[model samples]
Target: MPPVKQQPCPFAPLIFDDEEAIGELSSVVLQLHDALSTNGRCFTTGATEEKAAATRGRIESVLLNAFCTIFGQSPFERFSDIFDQASYLAEHMAKDHIFEDGNKRTSLVFALSILALRNVPVVFPDNPDPKSNPYYAWIQDLVSGKRTREELAQELRSNHISK
Candidate 1:
């Protein structure tokens, strides 16, 4: 008989550390990028990825581990480590599809948490009216495999950022 194809594990929730919960929380944002990328999606905040089986699990584990791995010494750090100058971390997390569902929302919360730590509040752009919002259209472009990380970064820096 042919080999059995195992279905993807979909559970992989991230846990936060007491000392570094802030940065660890940001990891979920990155995980969102992994999730979207798994579904072949991108983000307007500058996140994108390619489709791959190994990529999903790897990102999930990394996200779960981010608390301990990267924030051991710096708990109150910034989001630049993951996002760098391009905000690719968001895309990386979304594309991987680390979780079974709701990865994008989770990531958004994660991003806001980072802002919160800095005393900067964030609100969802699409839900401004609480109804009939097109905020999530960005994910559709990625899920349909229409964009890449590089493309997203350039687009964000070019059109989204106001100088």
Candidate 2:
């Protein structure tokens, strides 16, 4: 008999300390990228499977392990909070150049989705001119590594409203 395909859970707890759970999170990231790539968004012109392979590997290795630390005998949590984890994920996705295009766009959407799944919706502060908003500069600082993950998490907390 052919094996039944398992569906990835979009609402799973933001856990990433183990290999198995990390694998699941990696799948979710890829699913997100796939959904965004063909939408006339950040995807590069003439994108190919070969380009996607690099992104997939980044998710499995760097993104999934961003919050992990080497303990005495095993890996341990560096950022146990979900917000911090989301920040790291977005940080790497934005700055790593995992995809040839849409790095910032994809990272922001993925991070926001992770938060939205937990019933917290981000509310961008009101700015008359969206192009001149400080939030964009803040995100740029994050992508450039000028802002730490903890700082990003705190900012995210401040910008969210309970839903």
Candidate 3:
């Protein structure tokens, strides 16, 4: 039998179907939904963590007022601004105890979309290697008060906007 050769995907520019690509998008949407619907339940199987519960309350209040307070604009802003806001919200929300599952995933998607809209250069892999990616730790640091908003903003500017 002759060996078969796979042709290049023409839609590569418009769409990506590799496991990484598919999982990348799915992870984002799933995480967002999970975080939103969790009702502040702790992700653990047994007793809920007190800090996590508190975080969830704080997250809900913030998400509810995200548009009015932070952006002072409608959610239907230009795609760029919308994305930036989403990213910011996702990052903040992930640190909170909003969902029993998928908080980080949700935040990552939000951040990626925001950067895409801003035309800022940010990198996010489909199967994110936590050891290499600074995103997860960044969010943790953010929640722990180790990283200030100004520092995060500066990082975004230096890494994405400036480039």
Candidate 4:
């Protein structure tokens, strides 16, 4: 039999990296969610440490599925814009079913941390009503594919969002 050749993925552009920093940040996000969620009943209160760790791992894995190229065992995306990267993180985390509770919230915080790491100042709504809050609507738009990653990045840079 002849050897088979691997082909490039058409969806490679929609991936992210599972870095140690993202993993650590996810742990913190999950911990905060567990603590503040539904008075500590957001479903993580009873989860074992192993379960929490596994969730963190899953979050990292989900983030690693983006437009990337592997080089010498290391994978990297084509773009390095801070706003773009951070926005994508939040967008993916929100869309991907990676948590039983506080998924979007955790993802937002996690993504925001990425911005903080680079000192990219951003403003976000503080649990506003979806009907009245543009930020909340923006998130909905993002999940629904109405808003592009670049759009979100622009919003973050503009600081038009309010808490």
Candidate 5:
């Protein structure tokens, strides 16, 4: 078969040095999950609340490992850029498939929420239907490794409020 075409990634990696920040991230992630559940979007496949909380805790641990450092060393002290942080949340949440339903939608909302927390004005193409938007396609491409994280970071930076 011909080589599969790669799509551009819409997120970049981030690193963290603060436990409080990690806690904040975990809280945000849980809040998103709860919100989805309230909206009838999240289905845990019959998992109990304790099980779900355990799963979320595991996710938080993984996130911390990916984004945090034990010592405030030279390379570890730097946190992920805002764009990268948002992208990481979006990509990982979607790719993990933790929720039985609406994982992608949840991921998108999480990403946007991260941006909003940073006071970044997120701009999207004026598309009424998400399935019809190129941005959605781009995110899929990113998840499939068709696009690089650096490219996503550049795109995000270009569209950020600072731009």
Candidate 6:
């Protein structure tokens, strides 16, 4: 009998290094959805639930596309690092305003989730108040184009988990 060769995958491997990381991403997405839907901390104005779900779908699509070597778009640019990818995700999600509300929170959550999946520990201010958290304003700056992706990446690097 002759040996058989397997064909390469049509798309590039996802940002995740392994199945566990992929699973973590899935779990975080679900968590974000639930937190937004019921937490009352982040709420959408008109067509709230539907828009929230839509945003979730969009996030899933973006993550999937990040794996594609050829056809993928958005955060999957060539020679980009994980920080750049995270910054892209965060900026677009907030700027696009996919939801009537909570876009900023969702964007931050997605970015942090991506980092966490990559084993990057992102430390925010100890203050639980959003107004007191510098990251909130910083993310807004990113969305508004006042800040560059490199700036976001630098911030992430500064706060990287020592482990």
Candidate 4 positional error at 37, Å: 1.8
Model 2 alpha-carbon drift over 4 Å, by segment: 1-13, 17-21, 46-50, 66-76, 125-135
Return the candidate ranking by TM-score, descending: 6, 2, 5, 4, 3, 1
Instruction: Output the TM-score of candidate 1.
Output: 0.38
After best superposition, candidate 2 residue 70: deviation in angstroms?
5.2
- Across 1-163, the per-residue lDDT of candidate 2 in tens digits comes to 9999776333223545677776776778776776777766555565468766666778777655653444532222465456776777778887887777767666777887777866667798536343676655566788777888789888887777854
Please provide the root mean square deviation of candidate 6 (C-alpha atoms, Å).
Answer: 6.6
Candidate 6 has what TM-score?
A: 0.68
Off by over 4 Å in 6: 1-31, 45-57, 72-79
For residues 94-155, what per-residue lDDT tens digits would candidate 5 score against the true structure?
A: 78776677666677677777667557767878364667866666677777898855666567
Deviation of model 4 at 13, angstroms: 16
Give the clash count for model 3.
1
lDDT of 6 by residue, 97-162 (tens): 766567777778788776776677688784557778788877878877899767987787688676
TM-scores for every predicted model:
0.38, 0.68, 0.48, 0.64, 0.68, 0.68
Tens-place lDDT per residue, model 1, 87-123, is 3444545565655555544443453344344343334
lDDT of 3 at 103: 65
Better of 4 and 5 by lDDT: 5
Better model by lDDT: candidate 2 vs candidate 3: 2
lDDT of each: 0.42, 0.67, 0.51, 0.62, 0.66, 0.65
Q: Best-fitting candidate, measured by lDDT?
A: 2
Better of 5 and 6 by lDDT: 5
Kindly report which residue stretches of model 5 are placed more than 4 angstroms away from their true locations once superposed.
1-21, 40-46, 70-80, 126-128
lDDT of 3 by residue, 38-154 (tens): 645325343257855564456545444443323454433321333345445655667764555656655655655545644655653434554566766665676678876555655
Say which prediction, candidate 4 or candidate 5, comes out ahead on TM-score: 5
